[model samples]
Target: MVDYATARMNMVESQLRTNKVTDQRVLEAFETIPRERFVPDHLRSLAYVDEDLRLKDDRYLVEPMVQARLMDVADIRAEDVVLVVGAGSGYACAILATIAATVVGLESDPELAKLAESALQEQGVDNAVVIQGEMNKGYPKQGPYDVILLNGAVAEVPKALTDQLSPKGGRLATVVRSDSGPGKGTVFERWEKAVGRRTLFDANTPVLPGFHKQPGFVF
Candidate 1:
């Protein structure tokens, strides 16, 4: 059996801390959340590895380094309401719940959504809820979130999701993949009348489903 606690500590010290993930809260959340429970039984041992854990279909629980960096960039506050797209089995939601006041995890896969909800509830993550929905559309019922996190990479940030930002300085963090270059871990913050973007680091997370760029018609 894998010593999950030791694995979490090793991941925190080796993967996250060494990579500049300095936020104490973010680090503690990663260490506290039972990452193995969020993955399939066969993948449980690999949960603390420094790579994305594929859940089902194209879904993944992003690597610890990437998720930590993004959470640090998001700078989630205790009073903030967060929305996590492609929430998969709810690892990200559980992490966010540690910092944010409320969390909404949107997942398109019914099975994954159920798994997320069940796992979160089992873990007593009462402030977070998992809901089934189109990943790209986002859950508008709890609109204008203080923070938005995409659980995987995307060719481009969807307008639908951006439109859900709090507008009062809400921030969205994700890995933006490029065809010509490496994917960039980026943060987009809503500014007065506009949204500004900044790249924090290079990331290569697998693109979440429905986020690929649509092909254009040939002339």
Candidate 2:
């Protein structure tokens, strides 16, 4: 049988550390989380692979390096409340739960939300709460989060999501499309009265459905 623990450690060292994922806390969370448990039973064997794993329908699991990079960018804290948008299968949420005080995992797909809830519960992750809702609409009831992490790529960061930040208390990290070429990893942090958004790294990821631009109306 393949040693999953060893694979996880190797992934952290080879894929994450080499790619600039230097946050020790984030690396530790990645190494400890049982990634296979968050994936479908049939695809568990490919859990530690360097490629994105396709789940049911058009949704997909983000690559390990991509996820690790985003978490490092967020720089989660023990006292922070995090909101995980597009929380697929609770893998990212599980990672956030390890560092943050609380995690709100919002998913639009009912089945996926249920799967995430079950996965987190099975892992005894008590700091996360799973909720089903429209992917484009940010979860406001649990608002004032210390950090917001979008699990999928999008053309732009929604204002609704940004408005949920706790004053200058948090930041939002996501995969946003660049004006040219492929998408770029971006981070938005509240600064005084303004929100400063910047692209961190070039990335290629499947765009989340709800964040797509609407088609122009015919004349």
| Candidate number achieving the greatest lDDT relative to the actual structure | 1
Q: How does residue 199 of candidate 2 score in lDDT?
A: 78
TM values, all candidates: 0.98, 0.96
lDDT of 2: 0.89
Off by over 4 Å in 2: 178-180, 217-219
lDDT of each: 0.93, 0.89
Candidate 2 lDDT, 1-219, residue by residue in tens: 778899888888999999999899999999899999999999988899987899878798999988889889887889999999999899999999999999999999999999999999999999898999987888999988889999989888888888888787579999997447888888899855579987788788888879876676999
TM-score of candidate 1 relative to the true fold: 0.98
User: What tens-digit string does per-residue lDDT give for candidate 1 at 76-147?
Assistant: 999999999998999999999999899999999999999999999989999999989899999999989999
lDDT of 2 at 196: 90
Counting clashing residue pairs in each candidate, in order, gives 0, 0
Best prediction by TM-score: 1
Off by over 4 Å in 1: none
